[model samples]
Target chain A: MTAILLISSALFCAGVYGLLSQRHAVGVLIAIELMINAANLLLVGFGWRTGGAFGQSFALFTMAIAVAEVVVGLALILLMYRSRGDVQVDQATELAQ
Target chain B: MNPLISAALVALGLPAALALLLAVVPKLRRTGKPAALLSILGSLLALSAAGWLAATWLHDPKQVLDLTTSWLPQSGKSMSQVGVHLDGISVSMLLVVAIVASCVQLFSLGYLSDEPAPALGRYYAYQSLFLFSMNLLVLAPDLMQLFLGWELVGATSYLLIGFWFTRPAAGKAALKAFVVTKFADSGLILALITLVAWTGSFSWNATLPAGGAEWLALFLFIAVMGKSAQFPLHIWLPDAMQGPTPVSALLHAATMVAAGVYLIVRADPIFAAAPHVRLFMTDLGAITALFAALIAMVQTDIKKVLAYSTCSQLGYMISGLGAGSLMGGYFHLTTHAFFKALLFLAAGAVIHAVHSNELSDMGGLWRKLKFTTVAFVIGSLSLAGLPGLSGFYSKDLILEAVHESGNPLALGLLMATAGLTAFYMTRTVVKAFFGKPSHAAEHAHGPGPSMTIPLLILLVPAIGLGWLAGPMSKLYGRSYAFHLDTIGMVTIALGLGGIALGWLIYGMGLLQALPRAFAPIARIANGSTVDDLWALSYSKLGMGLARAIAWFDRYIIDGLMNFLGWLFMWSGQRVRTLQTGNVQDYLYAVFGAAALIALWGGWR
Candidate 1:
């Protein structure tokens, strides 16, 4: 279970790198979702490892948080499209300070 | 809350409440006079608190009245401590702000009363805010409070500077003061953060850790330059006079401009830790004093001359600090406060009497406004360091402190600057009131009862504060009588020389013949180039650097945004083309994405 958690953390970091490197809008979005799922996968792995129902309940909360995240995330994409008619996050790099 | 805490909080609240009540109630906002009266009263109360602080100082120099309670205590971290420190420094500044703000408020009551604009309410409101922020600044227990006071002071300046919002010059002046000071404030904030991080507290105790003291000292001094109209950053002060006359007194003459020096004085123990920084402070003080006095020589505006006088006076105080006479520095500061505020208020009266700032536009107006002439003459005498006036004792203390500075050049420059201060001030006085009537003198009228009373009241301090210098020294337990023989003689010579030269040039019209000999150099010196160069440097950092940041933000930063916006317009049309009623293509792309992900994951 610890092995799974470690692998998922690596996967999330890789996902972030991929998201940053990607030029295409869909690829970046896919990479971000991958990062979130990687966290969820680790939570489930911890649930199996701990075996007290505590980690499992926490994983359930993470899943709920992940759902809200996706909803807001998709809404942002729609809003960006409405305003700028483009979903390329790299092109919308106004926060690059 | 303890007594000091309650008083501190109330002092901060009074002007703020006045600001709000006058604005919303409308009826209370009647003329500048009523608003000014309320503000003056509030400041008087605050100053009375300062006097009480001084009375406490007579017993114990470090007699702090701390009041604190639990605030945002984490599991391990302790509760936040909050209380005003009525130390020597805080008491000095508190009293200065109170006295100067009260006088300016009274002057404004009569000065701006006749202006038909509705902006008088807002001006009075901002003046109250200025007092509120200044009070917080000196009494602030921690860095956070100091920062709040700092920003509020700047904001009040922005509002007050642009009081005549319709005028482009006023708008520019306000913006220049805010943006320029913020630039210096950024450096100061960084230094403060660095100091706090290293020391874990912002109290003015003598326990700051090692290696960071020098950095903190330098940064703090830099902040002083920006705020106090010190060298290379003081250019915004004169332009700031474009606001109403009372605003001129509030900002340029009295409390707001001196906040920087007040900060330096408050942080004395911390700055003392860095010997080299203290030396650097000495040179900064010298350069600013000499340079400001030089520029003041060529000024034609009554307000601008006083503006430069503020710069020169602040230079003396800052130099006194560097000279290692804390008591002397503060003595000069207090005396300078009374006279400078009186001068600005008197200038305001004159501007009201004859609606112009140009000295050339004013002449023989002393006869028209009898009380103003008296007030202005006393104020000017103090400024030129006349004996028996407030300035003589304090300024002599500064020069003697400089003499004890063990630096001859510094002493020389200070004396030369003294002569220049006298010369230029007499020019301003002579040009405005002493000479034959200029056309503007026809409109000159004495200010009403409200104004004359404040001016007269200020005169009591203007002449009296000089005698208090020795007592003030005793008040803080570090008594030292200055060997002021040279300084005293020099003061008289400067005063007499200034009066003589003013009489010779304008009164005798002697310069009319020498125009061909002196015209080019005089024009160049006073013209925007030298002033701008002085201004650019005095503006705190090179305006070029600010222009660079603005240029990058304006052209590069905004340019990128615009580029993206343009790209969106063009590419958006193309993106719409991709969606040309083709559901099959969209499905194909999604399936392709899923297939790619599946293949990638399967390989991993």
Candidate 2:
């Protein structure tokens, strides 16, 4: 369980760093996906330790949501690139100060 | 409702309704004939109602009618009321107003005939409003209602005096009259506030605090001096002649100027309590009388001559009242109303005929306007206090009152004023009617029946109203008899002598340069020095204080407001820096705030 947690924490930290530093819209989506996978890993580990399928079921639901979110996120990035010839998220800030 | 109340209501309401109709209805206002007809009809109805009220009073002169309802009620305290108070004074004033107002409206039809339809309609509307305001003042039961009516009449006077607002002189005259009277009205307002604060009532009969009566009387007389056009404040009346002649007739003769005397008579109890103020009123009246008559003697404009005469004649009435003779003052007011209105209307006809107000433009007018000449001569004779005319009777009574008051100086000044009144009037008549025809006078035309009929109607009162003095005296609950006493005989002599002296100077042309001897006096009388003095004080004192107040308002007061605005703007500028338009920065700050909140909650 401790090894599973350590790997999950490392993945979540990498996702946070990528989300803050990335300028491209696709890079941000990839970083978000990494964070969700890290949470799923922790959930599965906890379920196995408790000797039940409750946590594993939750992880399955989470994976399905993540798949739907990634599809929507990629579509938005494609529309932005078509409109502006670029998908750099920072340059797409129309509502910024 | 009582029948008398119903009559009073009609007398007051008809004109108010007509004024409203003529003012608000675009169609009626645009059409001259309908608006004039409506105004005349309203005035006649009010006249009949006033006649009815007078008849009721004559039937029982001793019976007083006071009907009031609570207007501003306060529990266990005195409240203001709205209603009528009909006594000898109010009823008499009502009849005079009704008669004069009706005559003036009728006269206006011809006097203002040359005006455009809309202008004529507007004129009649103002006339109706004036009638309503004067009647309201006559019928007021308390000082509060009286003040309301007083202010209304003053406003109407302003409107009427500036009726020809296209004329710059008329506009300025109206402003001058309004400001002078309003300045005096502050005294009245102060008296009213003090009266109410101390006595808790606005009734004339309210018991005043110690020494309050003198102050109130002094204040009231100050207002009278302004409204009645006494001495220094009288500068407006002559200038107010820039209005249409009929408006000048109504203002000078019966309504606006007479309201002051009526106020004095109505508030008799207060004046009676303040003997010192009464004496002051007598001396002031005497001075105004002689002063205005002196000025009248030198005026080149016919209307200005009559305007100054009005101020002089008003002085006589005021002097009479100040001498504690109600019958003398009020009776003179009644008689003066008829003859002065007659004289003004006659002058209006002459002006209408020659198309000029200057005396130089009018000579041998009698040959052209025969009936008007006759009317003018009679009015002039009455104004000069010829024997057996209405003016003689009233003027004698005032002189007698002054004589009885033991003010030898006032009596002497009044006597001199009577002679001057005769002299100036004779000079006017001789210059305007008897000399060779000027170019305008040669081509002059006579007034139509609309103008002549009012003159003919007023002629009766101007000639014979004096015979009713005994009955009028009875109305005041006093006994009076018409007799040519020593004072009466002396006044008649002075009047005739003045006429003779005027004939010698202007009529016979024996002493043409005699007037030149008095030119210095005339120059002083005609000078604008008094007016300039008032203006100077206003600029130096009133404007200076206003400037200080304005500076304080702009700097000190506005500085605090601007400081508050700056504080809010500075704080807003600091807070706006948080919005950098970067999603990453906003997210970081939000997450940091959430973590801090979570840690604090965990510690708690």
lDDT of 2 at B186: 86
* Model 1, span B1-604: residue lDDT tens: 5676576667667777877877787777766566666767877787676667666665566556655443435456642344465556676677778777877777676777666645666667777888888887877776556767887898998899898898999999998888778878986788767765666556556376685677888888887888888877887888899888777787766777777777777777778787788777777787778777777877788888888778888888888888887876788888888888888888888888788888888988878987798889889888888878888888888888888878677777777778778777777887788878788788777789878887887898899887766656865567666445866787678777866776677667786654355456556544355447755575668667888899999999999999999999989887767663433344447656876898899999
Give the Cα error of residue B480 in candidate 1, in Å. Answer: 3.4
Q: What's the TM-score, to 2 decimals, of chain B in model 1?
A: 0.85
User: What's model 1's lDDT at B503?
Assistant: 64
DockQ of 1: 0.01
Give the CA lDDT, 0 to 100, for residue B358 in model 1: 88
Global Cα RMSD, each model: 17.2, 5.5
Itemize residue pairs with steric clashes in candidate 2: A97-B581
* Per-residue lDDT of candidate 2, residues B359-399 (tens digit): 99998888889999999999999999999899999999999
Tell me the chain A TM-score of model 2: 0.92
